[model samples]
Target: MKLLTHNMLTSKCLKGVNVGYPLGIVAKDVKVLETEFNSEFVSRIIPKLDWDTLWNAADSIGHAGDLPRAVCDDYENDVEFLKKVHHVLVEVEVIEGELVCPESGRKFSINKGIPNMLLNEDEL
Candidate 1:
């Protein structure tokens, strides 16, 4: 799964959890695939992203060097910064990993670039 997808995921569906957003990533395999950069697309997505969560997730997988702690005010005109954001948001892929819910500690396995987010009956 792409970091972009991971940024939007949450584990709030689990029982007794208030806010299950920003699920923790434990990546065992990571791949960086080349993607064509679109500054407009990156700029559009910046507003929707949770910057801190994205930064932490990228850091967890050892890829946060280029990401800023917060989205800068002048990001739209910053090509270099946008390129870094684009790389993290689109190019980085998690091949194998587990997404751990912060509140419940439930783990969702990711394999072959797919994250299995289905909860067991008891979990629901």
Candidate 2:
């Protein structure tokens, strides 16, 4: 899955998880696929992202150097910054990994670019 999708996912569906946001990424294999960059689209998505979580996830997969620690207030006008965000959100792909739920420590495996978010009956 792409980091953009990961930013919006959570484990809230699991039992006893009050806030399951920002599932941790444990990427075994990662790939960067080239895509046309649209600064406008990246700007639009910035507000919706959890900056800290995105930063950490990118850091985990060795792609955090270009991203700033915090999303700057004037990010919308910063072309260089926007490009970095675009690369991280759109180009980076997690081919093999596990997304760990912070609250329950549940692991969701990702294989061949597909993340298996299914939970067992008891987990529900």
Counted clashes in each candidate structure: 0, 0
Single out the weakest 10-residue window by summed lDDT for candidate 1: 64-73
The sequence of per-residue lDDT tens digits that candidate 1 reaches over residues 20-92 is 9889999999999999999999999999998888888889999987688888889999999999999998899
Question: What TM-score does candidate 1 get on C-alpha atoms?
Answer: 0.97
lDDT of each: 0.92, 0.92
- Supply the global lDDT for candidate 1: 0.92
TM-score of each: 0.97, 0.94
Worst 10 residues of 2 by lDDT: 57-66
Candidate 2 per-residue lDDT, tens place, 3-71, comes to: 989998999999999898889889899999999989899999999989898899899889887799999
